[model samples]
Target: MKGVMASVQDVGAPREKLQALEKIEQDIAAALSSAASALQELSKDKPAQKHVDSHSTAFIKTLQEVENGLSQQISYLSQVTTSQPHEGSSYGSQKDMHMAMHRSAHVKSRLSELEKLKMEHLMQKHTGILRSYSASNDSQQPLTPHTPQQPHTPQPHQQPQQQQQQQKQTREQQAQL
Candidate 1:
């Protein structure tokens, strides 16, 4: 009989959440750029109805705040996420190893997200930087940004499969260590 091991396989990704976040991020990012432009438009020190576009004064303020906060987080979150060291396993029961794999999967998923966000942040940073640095002659462009399927339902049996794979990989890594 083949004993179950802690599985350590890539469990795809949370597509819906990722898609939603990416969409929201794009929307917010666009809003931010538009708000910046509107700000530049408004702060022109000119008085005109055209200058006073539909963008709310309050909305602009909020976008600026969010942009700043997200910008800061992008730099920091990316760095910390990449630098995070994976903890060594405590080395115990089959159950423990199994649990560890699930936890590691969760961490991996989060790290992947953080890394992606970090990249997006960097892109945004450069976009803002270049545009600001060369507002005089920058060309017009719109920045835009994956597919994963969800299981029909959770598989309790798959848990053992994942765990067994996890155990095998863990043991191999540990042996090398």
Candidate 2:
């Protein structure tokens, strides 16, 4: 009779352990389902993130480069203005030559102003983007990174010696010309 009672007690102990394990498994399943639903919500917004990233590239850089190109063109025009052609081109009157010179100067000045404004615009945009990314870094968002680092790093500051050397070279080239 005592043996039978001991056997029944052992069976009940195993049954209780099984029930506890089953409850744990159910709880884990519920947690996983909740996590999965949140992931689905995040996935819905991915396309919009893609759009912003597409626009976010050195986009301002390309714009700045264009402005630089325009500035170079403006500089060329200035050079042309400063250096008069040795040979004369036919002109009807002193007034006509004056008008043509005035027109060229006006165009050069306008372009310089436009290029300056464009450079400012590009700079403002670049700074704004930098601030936004710095803020994003502070936000501590999930690791779903939208941007990948490029192989080439962009540096804003030029070395003083390099700049001086470049200036020297430019002066030499101009002197030679």
Steric overlap count per candidate: 13, 0
lDDT of 1 by residue, 1-177 (tens): 111111111111346334534654775876776666667777776835464565555457656655654444454344345653212322234557799999999999999999999999877864564454345433343311100122133346667655554444334333332
Candidate 1 matches the true fold with a TM-score of 0.26
* The best candidate in terms of TM-score: 2
lDDT of 2 by residue, 1-177 (tens): 565334323333445535544554554555455445445545674545544444433344444444544444344344345663312223335657899999999999999999999999966765565455446553333322122232222235966655554444334333332
Candidate-wise lDDT, in order: 0.50, 0.48
Query: What's the C-alpha lDDT at position 87 in model 2?
Result: 20
In terms of lDDT, model 2 sits at 0.48
Q: After superposition, how far is residue 164 of candidate 1 from its true place, in Å?
A: 62
Q: Which stretches of candidate 2 lie over 4 Å from their true place?
A: 1-92, 139-150, 153-177
